[model samples]
Target: MRMFLKLNSLRKPSVHVKAPGVLALRWRLQRCCFCSSPQNESSNISVLRHLTSKIKATGPISVAEYMKEVLANPVSGYYVRNDMLGADGDFITSPEISQIFGELLGIWCVSEWMAAGKPKHFQLVEFGPGRGSLVTDILRVFSQLGALLQSTNLSVHLVEVSPRLSQVQAQNLTGEDSQSARDENEPAYRRGTTATGLPVSWYRRIEDVPVGFSLYLAHEFFDALPIHKFQRTERGWREVMVDIDPDMADRLRFVLIPAPTLASSTLIQADEQRTHVEVCPEGGVIIQKLTNRIAEYGGAALIADYGHDGTKTDTFRGFRGHKLHDPLEAPGTADLTADVDFSYLRRMAGTGVACLGPITQRHFLHNMGISIRLQDSPLCISPGSAAELPQRLYSAAPAPGLRYAHQPEEDGRALQIPRPAEPPAPLLSSGRHKVGEEAPSTTSGGWIQRTGTLAGEELRSTLREGVIGQA
Candidate 1:
């Protein structure tokens, strides 16, 4: 995970990481664990010095080249060995919030698996299964449904770039049910453990994840991939870059360069004003490949991220702990993310795999029964006991509870709490679906809209078959 670091020609200073624990510990000692000051100030200085030295040695270089070096630098790069999760980390993710979030997603997976004909062996893979709470909640639910868990023969796969995070996940999942048992005698969920009584495999990249009948889940995964940001200029959309100077440390600045060809058609309307457009070519490529895999093989995928309805503005920013920060603060230390492009995703998925959403995390989860699960939890009404409840359940918990995912609207700002939406119809016609002008309902007769076209009589016959199978 090499990051491209850069410095602006007009920047006051450059930011760099002197040592891993120094900046992180400074915040801890101050009890401002969420502060971005140390890394931002330090990174700016380090980057400025590195750039100045580089320019002296090799002459002037493009901002893009410099950023590439800073982030991906072999020895002192940020992403090489970073653990930016939890209260002391750069940012928190959905699975870190609560078990219900992952539990509901697990339920969603069950339905998807059944829709996919209940393959004897299928991989339930997650991208950055943060803190493993989501997976744990999911497995907890799986444990309850003995038939579903046993029948599917679920093999869990995780693609995590951070080895530190991988260990955290393994601790929560592969150990004995210590957390689930009595508090007084609770044991730590051991690392290198497998509570499933089943093996779990961890990999660094999606390409390494074995292909098969699989269910793909990526919550807040797309945004972290490096994005190419372009602002509409008089000439055309120019790419955004960061320039750093090693000598003038503690400063980082954003700059733009001409990129006539790479500028997207979507930026044409914003040409009158200097509107910024962001694109993650890497994330798009990954989506294309994953969609192709799902289409070719029998499977489903759900991607939840903070992104826009279309490719429009530059939605890139940085974060430390729970608060937002100037994106230019730290080269590699601070968490950098941008909005995902659902339009691009849908186009990539094509007809092979049905891409139901780029829907808001709220709406998607609501439709899939997150709210119901939340309401049923014992802690919902009795929430005042622990402030940790908000951080753990609503904010970033490693247990099975409520979780958060980002929702970026058109203006480029993100919604704090994702509101749930109605779930998309099942991708394949489950025997449960009745395709007809009249809305089909669950046997309990709950209204659900059907899109496109399917034979009405055939749909009803299929529904009846499901009813019979249940009986």
Candidate 2:
């Protein structure tokens, strides 16, 4: 979804999902290790029933609560118990497509680590590392650059709540080298070492990760965080809540409360412009944590998710079997997500960190010399698949599997995909720049962030070409 360029080849004719919130559908590459809802419709009942019990006791629940209980209830929650990734699951991530995404990221990590003066201790902390593909790719990069990391003590810390997916990450990354903690109550529930002797640890939350000059990565992670949906009313803003539909015992519906709830009153900005907004306090809290660490101890965080910069409203959506579905229907049977508001994340960061919101995979990769990388690699798409998509969806000069569904136009400008009947979404254009020229920056938005004072002059100059600026 983070990639604004690549819209999935829709299965249902004329049903194109809007972007920068993309869910790519393809013939398949890797089977996602995450558990998914069984074909049996009865399997979703437990989550639905539990929600009804909570609602009956507490009245209508906020959208945030609905998401939390439905996706992470610890008992019948979707993510807590499902394998919902890839072609067979509810979604597929950029990492699953090709090594370029992760490899470029790995290179960025090394570059940033160097910028941080090459700390003796390096921690690669990733949130929601599905099947461990991204981190595995990064680790390989680290090993490949033996001398660059030779003197640094490196570790992998993952903040993941899913026990089943944790097992998958362990099997893929550490194989026989990892083990569950003897005590279930430990802050780190699982611990392991890779074949190359790098230690890895897993935690249910980010608060437990040790503070250090670390590199933080969250790919397709923030959008899944529960968001409080609000609608601007004639008098004021009202929080959208979910309640049992009076006419149907088995269904849920959205209701606008007459008065603002604690969330609507506190989270909504008085200067708000959007008629609707989705705010994720959890995402804010996580950013605050990362920024504080960046400010205090010196680290960086690169968050990749589909989001708009203070521009979009009403992007909460659901996906089941790779197509749009009613978020309120069937409860835990689908994957519920909202577009990340990068502007809000900047507000939480509080100017302490140099935050960059969105650098399209196109810009970021091109800036990272992906053209050279692809030329040296063997990965390729079949002519059959290539012939199916519009030429603009792909540039004449190809980067293997880089279709990430978006292609730069002939004029070298990024193309914005609009939803049917909706205006063309505002282009997620990073402000302009070149070497020694001041770059335009809005403190309220952007994605890739490098913290600390040592962002490096050369790094800044090179990155400025792609709009990766120094604050």
Candidate 3:
């Protein structure tokens, strides 16, 4: 008999029910509120059984393989489910937090495009664009560039795997039927035009994007890719695997392969100390592809995610209902993710590709003149609320890194802003600097593109005291 051990002490039991029939009724009623639905749970059980059978037949699977199955398996994958993002979902992204994030990014894109002498035709691509909020905000900002918009033939390409998220992204992008709607038999690449007349397309892989001057944005993307975990043992490092828990037939647990193979040995080099490390070869592979695209074609790519510069520690975690959960507890129920090793990314970028700062997000935004934009805006909020903006923008993990790479011909200037010892104090300290005070001038030209008319000035002045940046 399999002895089931409850690993999650934090998980609370359902409310008490006296009668057996009433208990069954209560369970049916309460199932909707839980992380996994009864149907989903049943599906998970089936998947679990399938995995167990596979393991018994073929031996244990790598952590990456397990993650690939649980989070991206076509039929029963966690991302395949509709409810997987936002406040009600597993976790919220930075763009979902504030429009300011995407707006600044749009300004950066415009500046870079101008720096590149304004390419007549280029591809604007986003990888794993969750719900399309960031792209929508970016396009809105792009719309401010009137004549520039007309001159540039911008084609939007979203690289995504989840059909459900693609639908949401389509709705956000076009406000109607998506150009590249879900068709299992659909070719690797599909194209369409948005309601705004901008050419849009969907690609399952980055390689499918037509070669051209391409600007790619990947925010909180690389972390979700499956990773291989290795622990330094007395002899050497061993690869982590997922197998059926001997004590609990229905549960899964991590198990290390007994012998260290050449592949595992070549992949990771660890000291004698018992240290844990994670490597996302999938992420590394994607970086290689991206860097190749930028190097061969003329353009830039910006990757923003919470991670360290090659930290040798295990950062694998799961999130559900805005709270931490055991990653091994319930497969296909929570968001599984691991910290990115930015050093790995830099190394994979290759010889000619120039890499920029893996600087803190606070430093990046501040240097991008987030404060200046906030001061000139027409949003309203309390001083206390405004103070929390920096903290909120501070990622779940510290020091969100930003990497910028471009072709040698297209101005290889790095977007690295000097990091401060600490994040600057809030601009609106103690209610000082009343409305209509002269805002400080910036060296970087304004990308907001305000109309130079008396009525427009009046509107700007009115919005000067608003608190859109408080987020």
Top-scoring candidate (lDDT):
2
Per-residue lDDT tens digits for candidate 1, residues 1-471, read 101100001111111311111000000000011222235556545655676577568643443354445444544444444555554555444443344456656655565454334567767788867677677767765666565457656678878655556677777777542222233232211214366576577766678777776777766566567666555555655555554334344554443443444334443343344365556666667876776565455565656554444643544555554345445554566655555655555555445433332223333344444444544453632323323333222211111111124322223222232222222221211110111001110100010112001112332332233211110
lDDT rank order: 2, 3, 1
The C-alpha stretches of model 3 lying farther than 4 A from their native spots are 1-39, 180-191, 269-274, 380-387, 395-471
How many residue pairs clash (N, CA or C atoms closer than 3 angstroms) in each of the candidate models, in the order given? Answer: 56, 14, 4
Give lDDT tens digits, candidate 3, residues 393-415: 43332222111122112121211
Number of the top-ranking candidate, with TM-score as the measure: 2
- lDDT tens digits by residue: candidate 2, 352-418: 5444434444455555545545444423322223222112111112101101124222221222222
Superposed by TM-score, candidate 1 places the C-alpha of residue 258 at a distance from the truth, in angstroms, of: 4.3
Models sorted by TM-score, best on top: 2, 3, 1
The 10-residue segment with the lowest total lDDT in model 1:
22-31
The positional error of residue 205 in candidate 3, measured at the CA in angstroms, is 0.5
lDDT of model 3 at position 397: 27
